[model samples]
Target: PSRSATLAALDVRKRRDFTVHDLDHRHHLWHEGDDARRWAREAAKRATVVLGNIEEVEMATGTRNPVAGAAALLDLGAKIAIVKRGGEGVYARTASEEVTVRPVEIPVLNGLGAGDAFGGALCHGLLAGWPLRRTLEAANAAGAIVASRLACADAMPTLAEIETVLARKVSA
Candidate 1:
């Protein structure tokens, strides 16, 4: 579905508290020029949180820098913006603060579902009331774990698996 249509269909008043938009790279093929930016800005405005890769954000905002793109989303009324930079890290920005979670190093076998894994882990952290940094850490680890496995959905890490990855990071 078109981003605008998706936005139009959303009942922000009833679902804003839990709504999150993952402006994933796949959407790039569906939009162009100002339309993409407009849709992105509108999506941000309607959702409680917005998640996108750096490239997606840049494309959506017509900006070269992801941070600038995130700022634009915030200016458009997004409560939170998360820009995922593969290998480098994930950067999360709120009205009050910004946090960067470094990527976990792992051999990548498949990346198709890494973002989905990260988003799921992020939701888990948020629902559990974990701090932003910790949430990002777990999300990043989840992505790394998925990327390192040959299968996508089958590779999604369990809580114990995520903890193991975090523990390895700390010990290193």
Candidate 2:
């Protein structure tokens, strides 16, 4: 997975409003800093929303600098920079402020793709015109829904499930 960051970034660049700037630039098992930063600068030039996993970004960038990462997005004039922290929470940054949305309580079944689902749903929610708070809440709910199930792709929550959880009317 480490070696695929570039491909992933390319896909995001082509398909989405985001482009991944892998701090790790080379196709090697380990990342090359200059190459990563170069590519990141390029990604920042294109995308408005940047999504990254803490692990992948750190591995490629060779440094776990959230502020620097945030700065990159800022330099690119991105509106949102989302940093996914598994089990801990999700961090979101805009030009003016940064918010860390804590995770909801849910049993962990399979951790794989939880972050992807969260990012997808988060972006979807925002695109659907949900407020930032509601978007983060929905993303949090999506993460919980995936965690509650046994498989990764199969575990992704439906829109109804996300709304039900975000609504907070359903009891355990």
Candidate 3:
């Protein structure tokens, strides 16, 4: 599915189902193919939140630097932009603020579905009206927890589990 189309569709239902709308563009695997890159510009303009990995951010903003790509996304009209940096960490920006949450140190296992965990946690944080910095920290923990486990969906960590990891880190 195209993030552009998905965000557009969700925009219509914004009054009913969701308050915060987010777009997560892909590099090229989406239905729009190469055109998806062009579509991302419009998608970022339409969405209040834009979240994607480095490649997706680069594809959407037509920029090489991930940080600059995130800034471009916000300039295109997104109220916030989140760039997932995998092992490096995650960077997020809004009109008023920006934050970079470090990756949680953990044993590696399977890497599949980590993005799902990260995105899910991001949505959860947004829906709950948490600050972007706090949200990214939790989201980072969620992805790390999933990556440190054996599988993806089956290993998706609960908020409690994520907090536990964070708690341990805070204490250590």
Estimate TM-scores for all models. Answer: 0.89, 0.70, 0.85
Q: Backbone clashes in each candidate structure, one number apiece?
A: 0, 3, 0
User: lDDT per residue, candidate 3, 124-153, as tens digits?
Assistant: 987888878878889899989999999889
- On TM-score, the stronger of 2 and 3 is 3
Model 1: worst 10 consecutive residues (lDDT sum) = 9-18
Q: How well does candidate 2 match the true structure in TM-score terms?
A: 0.70
The Cα local distance difference test for each model comes to: 0.82, 0.65, 0.77
Q: Please write out the lDDT profile of model 1 over residues 59-131, one tens digit for every residue.
A: 6677757678778777766777888999898888889989988889899999989999999998989889898
Give candidate 2 misplaced runs (Cα > 4 Å): 1-34, 59-68, 168-172
Clashing pairs in 2: 23-60, 23-61, 24-60
lDDT of 3 at 151: 82
Superposed by TM-score, candidate 2 places the C-alpha of residue 84 at a distance from the truth, in angstroms, of 1.1
Error at 13, model 3, angstroms: 4.2
**Per-model RMSD to reference:** 2.1, 4.7, 2.8
Best candidate, TM-score-wise? 1
